[model samples]
Every structure is written in structure tokens, then in C-alpha cells.
Target: MSTKTVAGNYFEDFTIGQEIVHATPRTVTEGDIALYTALYGSRFAATSAATFAESMGLERMPVDSLLAFHLVFGKTVPDISLNAVANLGYAGGVFGVPLYPGDTVTTTSTVIGLKENSNGRSGVVYVRSVGTNQKGEMVLDYIRWVMVNKGNLDAPAPEIVIPDLPGAVAAEDLKVPYDLAGRDYDTVLAGSPYLWDDYEVGERIDHVDGMTIEEAEHMLATRLYQNTAKVHFNQHAQAQAKIGRRLIYGGHIISLARALTFNGLANGQSIAAINAGAHANPTFAGDTVYAWSEVLERIELPGRTDIGALRLRTVATKDLPCADFPYRGEDGKYLPQVVLDLDYTVLIPRR
Candidate 1:
């Protein structure tokens, strides 16, 4: 719980096989679901109306895949990117399993490669992080790269090794929740703006509003991820486990954080690139989710910047007006209300 600042630096600081353990585990809840549905306008039947999900063969719609990825990644920030200069890219990502409403999420990383910038001021570090549930089953995995500052040229160079990763997941790897098969579309109630084609790069959007999550809300999300590690669902679990009440789902925080980023970042609709990101601490229910963003880097691909890449940060909390907010409690640990800290790259339209 020390409040010391972290010193991060250039590629020279990273070894090909070092592992980073992020601090704090999170629980998921129902509030996370309601906010996700309200903010993103995603109408996957399983996620929204519960009745629809039951028909699809699920106990309930599981958290979205991107949401799950964000939660796991968010936990790695303070330990990994406090000094990051830029996010580079993503690869070899996979969704390992379904997440439920009351589960705890934890993450770990293995360094893959380190490439020093010819200029020596900065370099890129590639890493693969995996997210796991309470039972220790893999929930999500992905590869990412980041630009880091080189504080000193004298820093020793470490061995560089890259990992082999798959592009998209095979259908079999996808764990469709119980009872979820065919979807029930709610065209009238669902507010979809762009359908793959409607997006153009450089366009920014505001997600509009925020919502507060309750303890129960987060518990539900953790359970949905099938992250049954007790700390997320039972108070008794915390007494014996040393964790507090059922933790909030890292994915719930991710979704809420991403939704909060709608303002100023709405134009970057597609997630063309995932340079790198992390969840700084555990977020619980009763935290209000809020967000804002910046356009960090862009690229022109073939005939288009039509879809551009944007580096962004999305933070969540237990109350309103989280813009320019502060994290950390007097004890030096995360505040009870603060939920998340995230950074990533998204695709935007440039038409």
C-alpha cells in the first residue's frame, strides 16, 4: 500500500521472459451489465433482456469479450506502465472462458520482446498477459507492446524473445454460456448508430452519461465470468481469503470505463489496434463509472485513415464527475470507491 511513484523506462529495462503481477483483484456485478447496455448500445440478446438470454441457453448473458479483456489488462497498469510513453500494438489474443456476475479477476504478464528505438530516447516492449478466474482458469489472453522512456543509456540490455500468438479465436475456443444460442434482436429499443460501415476515422463521440454500481451489481458480473473465486461473491470468502466482499468484475469496470470514454473518443469506433492497457486497482459496486479521452497516435493504412488508431484512458469511480479525478486512499491502497484505470488504442473514422 505504499504510495511511491513507479519508474518505467525504455525497452532496455525489459527482459524477454520476466513476469509482472498486477495488484488488486476485481469482482463483477449486474450494474456493470446495465451500464454496458445503456452506454454502448450493444443489443446482443444475451447481454440485455434476461428472458432473451435464457432462451439462448445461458444463466445470463456473459460480459462482452472486450469487457473481459479490459478488466484483466487494467490490473497490470501501475506495475507495468506508470512510465509508458506510448502504446504500440496487440496480437495473439484469445477469450479463454465465459465470465459471470460474481467472480474475481487477476492477471500476470510475461515479457516477450524488447526493441530499442534507434534514437535511444524510447523503445517498445512486447508482453503477453493472461487473466484468470478465482478457480485459476484462464479467462482471457493477449499480446501487447508499449513505448517506454529510456532514463539512461547505460541500462543493461536484456535478452529479447517474442511469443507466437493466434490472430482470431477458433469458434471452439468460445464458451457460449449455457442456454445461449439464437439471439432475440430488439431493433426498436436498441440504439445502434454505426453498423460496421457507418464509422469514419477522426470522429470523436461522447458516450453521454454515467451510472453508479452497487455491491450486488459487481458480484453478479464476477459470477457471470465464471470466476467463482469466493472473494468476489461471499463476505465469508473475504474473511478467509483476505479480500473484501465479492470483488467487482474487472470486465464490468472495463465496460463501464470504455463506455465513459464515449466523449471525445466516440469517433474511434472500431478497435483496430490494442497497443497495451491495465487495470490499476480493484473496483467494487457503488462506484460510478465516468470517462474521457485523447487521440494519441494515428496511422494511414493503404487508402485510409478512414479508420485511425487512438490511444485512450478510461477511469471509473463510485461517484459522479470523475474527470481529472484522484485515486488512492489515505492508507496508500486503492480507495474503496475508485474502480478502474485503463489505457488502450481504438480504431476511429477519418472520412
Candidate 2:
């Protein structure tokens, strides 16, 4: 037998402090921006119009933050999560600089924690990954943990190590582009008149729109990111599993929810940071995704009167409308219809 074929890494394969430089550096382009917009219908003015972005002091429209996130995340899949059963959660994610079309992105990850499941059939691997541009400027940094399947059920468990992670990124550390400060923003062109001052803490906005997920669209988006997780593909193999269907990548749901928020939050132009996120439930093709957002906190940036930040909790529900803000049960368990619960910071114009 040829020894060239390689099986992907499992729980037993990772060690504390191992560094992995991911493959396939990707250069963002106009084509990716167009395709992503078509896939999710994202309409933030800063990402959609060059003229609008220039009005806000950017030379050109930058790619959507989520698109940059997906591209960087895709590079880590082949090396980190090829055999993952599930991606658990993310924390302390920060975007350093806006990624322009011509910028090339590469990624590296460090294994920071590990824990064997009581069943001994699986384990969780925690890694902190950083994506940097060609100039070696860090574009994004975050910590994520995944549940990976074990190739050998009888393999001895690794030492349990769980790194201490912050529950959220502090407001003072949120990064805003240098050019974006002190610029007069246009709400009329931005689509929504609601500004940072308009949103009050504890206010909820039902996006009042839904998008049906198509198998082809999800698969294309996944491939565009170059994410090769088997559960997201290989329907025949998935049919034999518990869910019995290919899983939609959680990032897909996040982008969809973020896009849907445009109806009520169009003026919230840039994603300053991702505090935390979770895929509470799995979503499959044909499910109509709905979203709603609650304002968690309002922040004022020192010396900048043109912009402010809103800590928003955006939730995605599959086949469930957000009119009632569907979420966890009284027992603190996610309802079956809830697919995503994302907490992130958005920088919006100050009226």
C-alpha cells in the first residue's frame, strides 16, 4: 500500500503549545466581495460603495469583516479541524486593520488547551489563531475551541489544560480605522436612520426578514472559504450520522444574521470586534433563518464624536421567527430552533 495518503489529526495528535502554520495564503479580490454580497445580501455602505467609503475617509470599500473572518478561518481547517465533530465557541476576537481587496492573508495557530471527554471517544482542542497580511501586520486574532473525534477510541487521554479566556473584549481595546475617525457620515445613503444614540440598551430589533438556505449556496460559500470539514460535505457519509444531513457552517449563519440586521442597523457600518459567539444548534439546507438583535451596551470612544460602539447580541433561529426573541428555556438550555447566539461590537455613526 502506498504511504502517501494521510489521515487528518485527531484529539490525540495535538499537544500543548504546538504551533501550526496554515496553508494556502489567499489574496482578497473584487470577485470575492461580489460573490459574498450575492451570497448574503450584505449592504453596509462601507463595504458596498466606494464613494460612500471614501466619504468616510477610506480610500476604497473594504471587504466585509465577516468575509475576512471566513477567509482567515478557512486556512485553519485542513490543519486544525479536518476531523472535528463540532466547533464549540469563539472568544476575544479583534480585527486590527481593514482588509482591502489586494491584501494577502495567511494564518498561524497555537494549541493552548485540551480536555478529553468523559466518553473517551472525543476531546476538545483549544487554539489561538492569528491571521496576518503580506506586510506582516496582524489583521485578526481570536481563540476558538473545537471538539475533534478520536481516531483510536482506546488511546490514552491527554492532560487536561483549559486556558483562561476573557468573557468579552473590553470596549477600550476596540479598534477603529485611523481614516474613519471624525468623518461626517451620511445616514440617508446608509439606508437606516438609526444611529448609535438611537439604540438604547435592552432594546430589541426583529430584523423581520428571513433567507432560505440553499445547499448549493452554502456549499459554494464553504468552498469559497476553502473550509474542508467533512460534516459540511459528503452527504452520503452524513446520512449515516445523527443529524442525518450535511451541516451548514456556523459562520454562514453568522453572516446571514449580520446581513439581515441591515434593515434596522444599516448605519452600524463596521464590526469593531467579536466578543464571543456560539453555535447553539445545527442548521441544514432549506431552513429559513431569521434574526433579531438586542443592544447590550453603548460605548463612547474618547476624542471621537463621529462614531460610537454598540455591543449587540444577534441571534439566529432556524425556521423560527424572531418576533418573540426565541432563545434558551427556563432550564438554561437552547431551544431547538435556535442556531446561533453571537455577541459582537459594531461601530455606528453618532447622530
Candidate 3:
């Protein structure tokens, strides 16, 4: 089986109830760990330093959950969203077990439902995806929906049905890391004035800064996420393998997008629900990441009125902000340098 990529739109080409297995089985590495620490400044002991991890009773540092999620999601892009219109939403997500640096990740999705847009040019598809380690243990599972263009709207619909998904995971379903039961609170490393308190629903934040990635930077990230297909690392692989020249780490884009949300959505620092998210395009080194956000909906949790939920979008770019960064072009294609567009629910303190 050749590993050639899917082209044009994925919509008109898809069949309902079909199970699509995405290409790319990647193995994570230590280089990925170093890059994540330098970029995000996440000091969670389980992921940051080896000594800290063992002190907490773990054999070694584990990978970030965010990193694992993105790797699993990226593998599915070619087959699932090659012709997607826009992502609709997400739900039913659960992270089962922690992933180590050496674990290889591969993903598969089941098409759960389909809905046709009234205009006939586009329709919606829902897929349930699960990520598995090399040992074949399930690490994560989630459902996501995307708007995909129909190859032929005239093609008769197989079934006009949409699967039901929950808006948020029950508190009981959250899998807070066992080793992360306590925190030392290194304010210097965390880089923020806000904490569990001092946030308000509807408030927004802009994390005013940008960084340019290099070919080496993104490859390190992809490898850390254990997405080590030759295309991401070996420049020789690109010429010989025919993959793109530089593979940017998907997490770098995620960090930039999340950081950008700080300006308006900073108050929602404690993320309660992931809701759903996406990497709209492939990012390469030399891309300048920028970010901004809007508060979508607010919800108050029981006995936790001090914090509320805020849904937001974080986008990244290549050079500067694209006049239209995330939208499709007149040719109906994604603009270059717009690496990611993600929607998620975060926790903020009550004003």
C-alpha cells in the first residue's frame, strides 16, 4: 500500500458507516520532551524533569496529554479532512492511560453520522476516533464533527442522521493525573499573574508575542509527540520520501494558539473541558505564530461558582496575521501559514 496523501475534498469521497484508518504511525522521542519544556514552560513534574517524576513515584517523565492528543489527531487529517469545510464541535472524550516517550501512536475513526447542508455544496460528518499505543492499548477516545464539501451534492444521501454528543464530560470522567495531585506553584516558570481565582467569564486575554520555528524545532516536536514519520525529521527523507521539506511540531502551534488566547480568555486559565479542536493546516519552521480569541459561552459549575467555562478559538500564522487567517480562500482552500484553528472550553474565575 502506497502512502500517498489524499487530495481535493474528503466529503464527496466519503461513505457513511465506513471505518477509515489514517496513515502515519509515529514513535515519540526525548527530543520532543526538551522542545515542549522550552516552548510551553509547562512545569508539571510528570512531564518537565526526570528527578521530579521519580520523586512522585513514577519511573520516568511522561508525555504531555496535549502532545499525545495532537499527534493522534494529526494522523487522521489526510483521510478525514482532506476536503473538510469547517469543524463543528467535539464531545465524549476520555484519556485512558499515560503515554511514554517511546510509544508509537496510530489512529482510526468510525464515521458515525452525516448531514447535508441545505445549499448542497457541503455537508457535515461525525467521526469517533481512538488513539492506541504500539502495544495496542487505548490511550484516548473522542468524537468530532467537520463540515466537508460534497464531491457531488447530486450524489444521493446514504443517511441524513447526526449522532448525539455531550456538551461536556462529567466531572467524574475527568482523568486528572494521579501523580499531579499537588503543585509547588513556581510562579516564575508558569508566567502568569492569574491563578484559579481572579478570572471572569466573558473576559478575554491576548498573549502578545510570537516566535518563529525552524525546521529542527517542529521536527523535534513531532518526534516528542511520537509522530516520527521520516517526513517530519529527515530532510533527506523529504527529498527521498517526497514529504514536505520541514515538518513543524503540532504542539508549537497549539501553544501559540493557547498563548494567544491569554489576551481575552486568559481569565479562563483552568481548562475544565477540551470540547474539541483542530490543526487546520501543516505548520513549518519559519512560521510566525500569533493568537486572539473570543468568549463563546459561559457555564457555572455546581459549588464552583468561583470559576466558569469559556469557549474560545486560538489561531496561528506563518508571517503575520492573514487578513483572513482561518477562512477558506476564494478557491476554497485554506490560506498558507494558518496552522491551527481550535475551539475548546476553559475554566475562569468569577469576577
Candidate 4:
């Protein structure tokens, strides 16, 4: 009897070029940092110690990049992915200024691409979102696409418009903070002696650690980000579907893989950009996650000898060790044990 109740946007409800400003600006806090460290076991020195960060020319310890990413991504869930089937992939992601505690973040998204599925029950929606701090400075930006269910099967298909996106952020375009230069870093406090020049291209490092996922840990991590996706929380609903259990958020696996890398890559101080990423398979509670990394490329910043960038491919697997590099089958299909395949860049001190 009332048309007031609001359901989230469905596939058929979207129009290309529409702009949606998400609600609820969130303020970063020390509590968020503590909870994130507890959940992911991240040990990046720049984000873990204010004194160490200040020694490297930062004003204070910055929030973990993935933490900032999850927060901004959470803001778009209700307006963009609430009725989604799955988050498909990501591309052309770039981080701007470092986020510190007490800074507030807000987001806006624009629909950039759309394609109807042949099955007629679902379609893909692509959106580019920009997250900005209270000072109106952009903190992060990225393009993500999701598969969303249709609210009306009979609705006529909208004109398809797929945006042409970059495969990677250009090396020259990466912004290294001005204060993060000068090579005055402390190796002892940073937790590793490896520097930019120490890593050779084509080298692979198995992180040699595994952490079994617990139901409560993932639930708490997802809730802390304010992510309200039902597939991550509703077990009864998921029990009726394929997989038969709640799916662990892919970002959770990303953070776990990043944390495990501290064993070998602790000196790789900060994330520069995310070139591409894919959640190859779903993860569930009780799966033991392991990680491995391959150095793809190395770039020297034009004017700065203080730091350089390493292009890395970090792979996460469940119940499988990465000693032999378990990636895909001969036919190019991901193995059942493989859960994440991420390609990104990180900045490390130069010797």
C-alpha cells in the first residue's frame, strides 16, 4: 500500500553516465587502525609506527592503504552493489594523498559501462568511484565492475556502452609523496634489509606462512569496514545456493596476503597503484590462506633516487602452499585452491 520502502538499485534501474554520490562520510580513527592490525596482522612500519613514519618524513603513521580502500568501497555498496551477484574485477586504481586518523572520507561514483547478459536474468554494471577527504583532496580512485540481478526481466535492454579503460597506471603518473623522499629510512625499524635494488625482476618469493580463516574474524573485519553485503553475512540464505556457506569477502583475502608478505617484503613501504586484480575463486571459513609474490618489473622514479617501484603479482591460495607456484591449469583455468590473483605496484626505499 506504500511506495516509500526503498530497495537498492537493480541492473535494469541503471542508466549509463549517471552519477551517484554515496552517503555517510566516515572518519578514520586509531580504533580502526587497531582493529585492522588485529584482523590482518599487517606489519608495514609506515602504518604501524608514528615515530618510524615521522623519521621517514611523514607527519604521522598513515592508515593502511587497503583499509582506506575498504572504507571507500563500503560506501558504494548500498547504492551500487547491493543487488549484485558478484564483484567481477578491478582496474586503473590509483592512491592519492596518504590518509591519517581524524580525516573524513566521502565518495562519488559514475556509471561508465553496461552490458546485458544473454541469460536475461542479470547484467554487468561498471562504475568509476572517487574518494575524497574533508579538504576535498582525492584520496583514492578506481574502476570496478559488478554483475547485478535484474529487477524486471521484461524491461528493454539499455544501449551498451563499455568504457575504454587503461590496463595499468603509467609509471610516470604514480605520485610519490614529497615528504616520502630523501632515502633517510631506518632498516632496523622497517623490519627488513631488502631495498628496491635488492629485488630482481622475475624473482618469486613464497611468503612461507599460512593463516586459517575464522568465521568471527572475517565477519568482524567486514563489519568494521561498514560493508553490508548480504552474501558475506547471511548464512541461511547462502546455504540454499552454490558453495553452501557464506563467502569470505575478497578484500579480506587481499589484506591477508599483504600481511603475509611482511615476511619478505616488509620494506616495501607503500602501495603505489593497483594495475589489475581478480578474485579467481571464492573463499570460506576454515580455509587456510597462503601467499606468494613475483616481481614483474622495476621502475626508477625520474627525479628521486630515494625510492623506486616494484610491479608485483601476489597470489593467494586456500589449503595449498605456493612452493611450486600454483596458479592455473595448462588450459589457463584457475585451480580450485587458488583464491586471489592481484597485480599491483609498491614503493620501496632505494639503496
Candidate 5:
């Protein structure tokens, strides 16, 4: 069976500068859009309706940013993190062209950094992956580090290298895929009255809703993205681990939290970039998730008056509400209830 089956990569097998072209390009479909909306109940107009997208000067409505992100990220999992302990963090994520249905996305990645854990049982691998459409247009570009188990405990550790990542995606570097072009934007239909100019730096918003994860629902979400992460699927394997159940995919929490943002940030229509993110804690089935966001900075484009950007910090927690905005503790670690800490940028109309 040595050449008949694939067991996936382990920590010791990775090296810096290695380029990996991931398998399987996925075509986005209206069916994918429908299932995603049913799972998260996302209501962003520009992505929700083709008519609303035309009003925003786009030829066709785009899929949700997080959906595009998940599809791309899923493509990298088998080669990058199949025998993984956890996916640690993400940084410098930039979304380029709008991903409309029928666009096929393919992903390729490069090993940028590697560090063996002190225990010799695991190590961290940093990879930069780029997802491009069949037209060769970039869809999503980002960096992520994952902690992976070592299949051979006796294998020697390689030279430790950690890539220097950006603190945030600079405003000048943001990609504005489309302009409003003086078209009419209906606030009432969009579900929010607030615009770019109405929000202030450091303003916090509680999304004011909670959703409990179901065992079947999390599995469906994982499969919908075609994310073949064993930890998310194999309850038998996970039952032996400390968590003792099927682990919920981290992207599930990101999508759920992003969906909750609609209640307060409905007008923050398009995601431009993901500066950074961390899954502070693991989430399992039956845990109720809630979310909130803080405006970190406001960005004005150099020559555009139709729209602007907001650097946002959106936090998601399990079994805790964000009324007081739960986050880092006195020790600088995230609160136990916190599941996701995401720093991203979104575009909103300028009123």
C-alpha cells in the first residue's frame, strides 16, 4: 500500500521554499450560494441579489467573501494540514476580483516558514496560498500557519524560520473591485441606515444574536466547502483526543460571525482584506456562538468619493454574549469563551 494510498504530509516532511499546487479546482454555483445562505442566513444585499449588485455597478452579484475564502482555503487543507493539530492563524489576506458564480478557483501554496515544537511531537508550518480564477485573475491571497503532527517522532527538526507578517493590510494596498459609479444605493433595502461617515474609530457594536451549532450542521458546512480535514469529520479519531468529539471547523465560526455582522454592519457590504485572525479556542457542536465588532480605523480612498473602508476587529465567542464585548483578559490572552478574533477590512458606501 506504500504507493497505493496517500497519508498526507507531516511536520518533518515540509521545507521552506517548497511550492505545492493543490488538487481539484472547484466551480462556484448557485447551489453553493443557496446552501451557504441557508447555513449562515447571510443577508448582504450585494451578494444576495443580482439586482442589488447591478445597482452597485457590478455586472453580476458576487458570492459571500467568506464563502470564496473557505473554498480557497479548503483546497489547501489536504496537503498542508491533513495531519494537523490545529490551524493557528491567518494574515495579510487580500481579496481581488469579485467571485461570481461559474468562476472556477484553483489554489497553489508555498512553504514560507517552519518551526518544530519543543515537544518534538508537532511543529508549525507557514504557507502563503494564492487562489486564482480560470482567467488567471487572483481571487484570494493569504498566509496561514498550522500546527501539524509528526508521523516520525525520530525525524530531526529542520532549521527554524518564521516569516515576518504585516500588522495590518495597508489602506493603499486594498483592492476596490467596483465603484458605485453614482448609482443609487437603498439603505432600507440593505437593512442598515449607517454609512461609512457615520461610524467612528473605536466604536463597538454588539451584533445581538446567537446561533447554536448542530453536529449535522457543522459537518454539512465542512463538506460544502469540500474541506477534508479529518479532525472535523472523524469523531472516532477525535474521541481519543482531549476535546473528545468532532471539532467544528474554524471557518464555520468565521462565517457565522460574519453573518451576524449583518444586524449592525449590513451596509459594510464588501470585504476587501483580512489583516489577521486567530482561532483563540476550539468550538464544538452544541456551543452557542455570538459576535461583536469594533471599528479600528477608517480609510478614505485616494480618489474615490463613492465609498470608503473600515478596518474592523470582529470577535466571536462561544456561550457568551458580547454585550460587554468579551475579549482579551488581564494576562493578554483571549478570554476562555472566545473562539475567534478576526481583524479585517470592509467597504461601505459614503453618504
Candidate 6:
């Protein structure tokens, strides 16, 4: 056996306040955009057509927000969640400068909290990760916590520290990086008549489409992100496990849900912030995924009249349609079929 091979980090190896600079800085390219579209079938005009993006006041066709997110999030897997049991949730995610083709992104993380599970075999580890472009400007900043396994079961558990995370990203702190001022947005080309002002709080839309995930496709998507999470790829190691199958990467579901939103959210082109998110259940190959969204708030940006923000909660389900909006039980627990609960904000042109 080669001792130089990476064994990955476990629960016992983490400590509060530890800083980790993840490896593999990836440069965004048109190929990545193409593959992302091929995978998720995203049809938003701003990212799909260069001329449309240019007319919208962007310097160039920008990378899809979630694609940029996965690329940066992938870099942290080797050091942060290789032995993860599950990715719990996300919060305070703000997209900064737009990610354009040819821009390179790197990531870094700091451990802020840790707790050993009562069973002593696993514990939750919380980290805040920041992704930056070649110009040293932030592309994305967010916090996420994962349940990780213990390599040394007998190792003494560290002092439990659960970091205080925000319930949501404040509207005022959101960065509106692109200038849509005075730009003529074509609702005809956008594919949706509804704009920011058209939506009222508490409105729910069921995205009436579903995509069945294939094993090979999920593997391809995982490889595209360069995500090296063991549970996603190690089939030989999973044969004896409880699920007995390769776990679908959670990010895959997020992208699928985002792509489905295009039917109703076509004019909601740009994702400005991810207020909060959670992978409620494990997703696997062969699960047919469905999605739906609710308008949580309609926020007006200070001094900006051309655009408005919509705080939305998008829910994803596996092998279950969202026409009835399958979400939680009266006891306040995520339904067994639900896979993702994502709270985010999108920037839409005002009519």
C-alpha cells in the first residue's frame, strides 16, 4: 500500500478555528457552461446567449450561479467532507463579483464548530468557506456543516461548539454586482411575463417537470465538479452499507431544481444570494426529482429601481411530484420523500 495516498480527514482530526486552504483552482470555461447546460438543461437567457447577456449590461456571458457554486464547493471536498455522513445545511451564502469565462476560482475554509455524536462514531463539523476569483475578489462566501465519521473511535471528543448561524442573509447586505440600469429587458425573450413586482409574498408555483437521474449521469456530473467525496464514487466500499448504492451528490439535486425553476422563473435570471439550504434526505441514482417554490418576500433594493429581489423557498423531492407540495409533517419534520429545501434570492427586472 502506498502511504502517500490521501486518507482524508475524519471527525477526530478537526479542531475549532483550524484554517484549511483547499487545492485545485479551476478556471471557468465555455465547456464547463456547455456541460452544465447539458446536464441540467438550464435555459435562462442571460447565461444561454451571449448577446442576451451583453444587452442585459453584463460584460460577457456569465457562468451559471449554481455551476460556479459547485466548482468552488468541489474544491473543499477533499479536505472538508471526504468522510462525511451527510451534508446538513447552508446559510449566509452571498454571490459577489460575477463569474465569467476564463476567471479562476480558489477556496478556503475555517473550522468554527465541532461536536461528537452520542454514538461516538460520528460528529458534526461546521465551516465557513470563501471562494475568490483571480482578481482576489470574492465570488461566493457561505457557511455549511457536515456530519463526519471518526477514524479513531476511542479518541477523546473535543469541546462541543456549535457556531451561531444566521437564519437568513439580510437583504441589505446582498451584493448586486451587475448593472441592469437603463437596460431594456425583453420579457418576450425572457419566457416569463411575471417580473419582480408581479409576484406577491406566499405565492407558490409547482415546477411541473421531473428528471430521472441515471447512475452514469450522476457520476459524470460528480466528475465534472471534480468532487472526490468517497460515498459518491466508492461503490466497492458501499456494497455493505445500508443504502447499498452510490449516493447521488447533493449538489446535483440543487442544480436540477434550479433548472426546473426556469419554467416559472425565466425572468428571475440571476441568483443574488442563498439565504439558507438543507439536504433533507439522501438522493440516489434512479430517483425522479421534482421541484416547487414559494415566494417568501419581495425586496426592493435601496436606490435601485430597475431590479428587485425575491426571497424564495424552493423544495425538491425524490420519486414524488410537488403538485401537492410535499414538504413537512404536522410534527415539524421533513417528509421522507423530500430531498432538498433551498431558500434563496433572485434578481429580476421590474416592469
Q: What is the C-alpha lDDT of each candidate?
A: 0.56, 0.91, 0.62, 0.89, 0.93, 0.91
Backbone clash pairs for candidate 2 read none
What local lDDT does model 4 show for residue 194? 92
- Tens digit of per-residue lDDT, candidate 1, span 1-351: 785955543456677778988778878777766655654444343445666545545576667556667678767655555445534455556556577779788999988777777776777788888999999988877787766666687776555455564543332333323321244433233234332244344333335467676776565555433443333455774666455555555556666666555443433433433434445555556666665444443444343322334444445565656555556667876565555545455543333
Residue pairs in collision within model 6: none
TM-score of 5: 0.98
Candidate 4, residue 74: the lDDT equals: 89
Candidate 1 vs candidate 6: which has greater lDDT? 6
Count clashing pairs, candidate 5.
0
In candidate 2, position 82 carries an lDDT of 88
Q: How many backbone clashes does candidate 2 have?
A: 0
- Models, CA RMSD each: 12.3, 1.3, 7.2, 1.5, 1.0, 1.0
What lDDT score is found at residue 150 in candidate 4? 89
Evaluated against the true structure, the overall lDDT of model 5 is: 0.93
Higher lDDT: candidate 1 or 4? 4
- Tell me the tens digit of each residue's lDDT in model 4 across 96-159: 9999999999999999999999999889999999999999998889999888888899988888
> 243-272, model 2: which lDDT tens digit per residue?
588889989999999999998999889898
lDDT, candidate 3, 169-220, per-residue tens: 6555544333322434333333455644444445444546666666665655
Stretches off by above 4 angstroms in model 4 are 1-3, 178-183, 240-243
Ranking by TM-score: 5, 6, 2, 4, 3, 1
Writing each residue's lDDT as its tens digit, candidate 5 over 72-122 gives 999999999988888989999999999989999999999999999999999
After the best TM-score superposition of candidate 4, give how far the Cα of residue 71 lies from its true spot, in angstroms. 0.6
- Give me the displacement of residue 151 in model 4, in angstroms: 1.8
lDDT of 3: 0.62
